[model samples]
Target: MRSLDSAREVCERFHPGLVKALGELTFAEREAPGSPVIDLFREHGGVGLLVPTEHGGHGADPVQAVRVMRAIGSMSPSLAAAATMHHFTAATLYALAPTEGRLTGAQIDVLKSVVPDRKIMASGWAEGRTEQNILMPAVTAVAAPGGYTLSGTKKPCSLSKSMDYLTASIAVPGPTGEPELAMAIIPADSPGISVHPFWGNDVLAAAESDEVRLENVFVPEDLIIRTTEEDPERMEALQLAGFVWFELLISSGYAGAAAALVEKVLQRRRGSATDQIQLVVKVESAFAVLEGAARAVLDGVDGEEAVAAALVARFAAQQAIAESTATALELLGGLDFITSSDSARLASGVRPLAFHPPSRASVAEALIAYCAGDALVLA
Candidate 1:
């Protein structure tokens, strides 16, 4: 498994310009509601980090992607969170395309456009009032002559204003007239697609996570992605792949933020040697667990095992980050906490890791069942 230090070094080496830009942006500036850091990131091909090399992207594997996310997370959690949406949207599409032979042409075109056009994609799949799974959207898609007219809203959609394309989940009628889950890649400028401001909070302000409302927006038939009635297994596999990638990458980003706190604490050198050592150990251990999970994915492990590994790693990293951040704050003292805006902002930033999908409370039962040898279905 790649060590955390080596991963950080690799990221810095490969994307020095990005790392330098991130370093130059103060926490306050990066966290500002309409910060331009994301645009800077996009200019440096941050949007195409996961695109295949043949398509003019770096084509990073799971482990390398984890490292890059961690590196970004250490510098800016807002960017990391926003970028996660982009990377995973691409990843999910890429991972599922071959299974159903969908999006092979679209993926190529999209990936090729990402670097040259500086195009960024956003994920518009969150429906606040729905009980459906993340992969199963609540948006209604009515069949049209050459496409589907979609109507619904995805709140807290990351990269709301900057996205050139949006990959969203929608519900379309099956052969039996029942709603079936499907995804569509719609251009941001499509008629009837509106962007609304919904994220009013200070936390993650720069993420541009607002509401994307689609009102009878027509998506061409070629952009629709769904499994055939005879290929239900492909859909299941796609779901699993998406879940694993999201969990792993998202957790790595937060871990980077937590790692940053640890680095800050070390630089000050206010804490006793023992305290610092303890913090380092905790942070390193957490990263190691994440590394193991990343390696498992890179080694071709998939399905239930991959899901379980990602969950376990994410929970472990969250605990470590929480504990390490709390300890760092205590050691840094009240004077620094009261005066250092960056320190205070980072402290607040680390708290959001708990709110990501598949909350511990909701998954506790399933986790136990899995440990007892039962199938690990998150839903």
Candidate 2:
């Protein structure tokens, strides 16, 4: 129901401030140790900027969030990744959480209208390793009186250091031997919780990425959002669907980066030989691809249809951004590689695309699964 126009406006309003502080701010440097964008977003209530007014948020829609994230990702992918992580997580809660009690009528309105003003939360579904090639988190949760105690390590959390809250998957060992996945909201500073920086120097400089370890961390009953005793394989599939959505949102950020890079290159190319009709055609087509991806995201289709839409959008946006960045770099030559130029900043921004969720292999497999249907089995 929401459009990107208002969101674009919000991004435009904040662009100047963000750009002005881009270099000097510690968070702007992907390799730097601070999280400048997250700080600024919180200071400006950036999440609240687009969040609705009902649940203490601005009642902002997904389009607005997506557009703003794209803008940030254009300038700084690290910032975009951290800022948007929770939105997808929130979407998961909205889509899967029980529709009664705390998520009741008025509360639901607030959530849909203005999302809850809870501390920032991120999902921790991925496990550290896998047996039989299936990744499962080493952390597990055991039932306690009021809630469950969660313990395990969640690595490379986008904004782990700066977030106030997180939703981690706990290994709930069932009566049957197999474990169940349960989502819980945990405070960032809870005792027995440790944060360790994990992202490498080459990735988003502004990223405050860290690995979170919960050792008997207590999650109150109210914090437990969802639990299912359904087939582990089936539940895993549903979880994958939610994860796919998050991946799609992230890819859109790259599209935004591509658009920004094009604008930066165009400014200097005017009256130059590089601005030929063919070149213009290539660039314009690239831009169109990104815009189409954005459109699919805003359309709000449901189920596997939504997943398919997101996958297509992500693939298109990635291709366009890869092309746009290469073109912009080639056009700028020496100047583009310098850290001072917007070209350099954007180049760095696009680097994160190499490692985000639903990785290349995962995305490819997901596409296969979607196309082949459940009955189609692998040999």
Candidate 3:
């Protein structure tokens, strides 16, 4: 409870009055289709939270970022889900800021316009593949005059109806004519880009996780970033940064959803002390692991180590959220379940964390190899 309260405090600190405004609407209203939650987030300057202050943004560190996500998730899981796409995209792009000559001028322009334009970016980098690393390119590209035409679809792309930019992973030829991974930052309003309905579930309808299609979409050479290393491992700096942030923020958000259910039971005082403490411990322990991983990132843990930490946090949270949500719902009792559908919906919202990118089974090999003193290879 203290952690959630602290999360709200951090939310208010970063985006003043955001928590109150989010709380103004009923959870059902906020979670419904075409909800105004994203607009609320934009109006409150949430898109700029992960962006640096010098770039006219809030400049929240990983720790504060996760805390904000928790607070927002506690209020609206859809907002948190959609915000993860925007935040992680911002984090990955700005991650290139420190190094001179790494970012093309066009790319820098995109990053600079974020805070000023209130830009919302949706990431299509994850393919959720079971055979190889999820970051492995799934988009087809053909070299054109001064750039390439990208053709692929990012299903379940969050902020589908409202995003201004789409950052996708594509494959382009390297020096030796082999296909290599590259980042493509394309405008959502581009000629050939379109959004279609894909997410059929209504659990987090406000997330706008729909299908984003790129049919003969052209991205300029300046907007595509390729790794400098010739034969870098499957996960490079860019991919690593994006993946770690993805896991941390996504888990924290789901933790918030579970927290909401826990809060209901707590507020009603329906359970014994032992039962209440068990619920709190389950959810808070998840938050604690997430916060610990975020703090480690702040302390300079990088590459595989950081990614491993994030995955551990995410998987642990997945189990904790599952167990806690069920326990909390039971503690709330059958009367609550029969009286309102909110508890059931909230419980379902946290279940997707287990189904998100780089699932527990998919990464077992990499984590095991890393533990055996071998370099972490995600392929």
Listed in order, each prediction's TM-score against the native is 0.93, 0.77, 0.96
Backbone clashes (count) for model 2: 20
Alpha carbon lDDT of each predicted model: 0.80, 0.58, 0.87
lDDT of 2 at 28: 37
The segments of candidate 1 whose C-alpha lies over 4 angstroms from its true place after superposition are 1-5, 97-100, 104-108, 127-132
Cα-lDDT of candidate 1: 0.80
- The residue ranges of model 2 lying beyond 4 angstroms of the native Cα positions read 1-8, 12-31, 49-53, 96-98, 102-118, 127-138, 173-178, 228-241, 270-300, 336-342, 363-366, 372-379
Query: Largest TM-score belongs to which candidate?
Result: 3
Candidate 2's residue-wise lDDT over 3-86, tens digit each? 223434567574435544544553335435675666765655555543435446554455555567766665566767776676
What's the true lDDT of residue 40 in model 2?
A: 64
Which portions of model 3 show Cα errors greater than 4 Å?
Answer: 127-132, 229-235
Which pairs clash (backbone N, Cα, C closer than 3 Å) in model 3?
Answer: none
Sorted by TM-score (best first), the order is 3, 1, 2
Clashing pairs in 1: none
lDDT of 2: 0.58
Angstrom error of the Cα, residue 247, model 3: value is 0.5
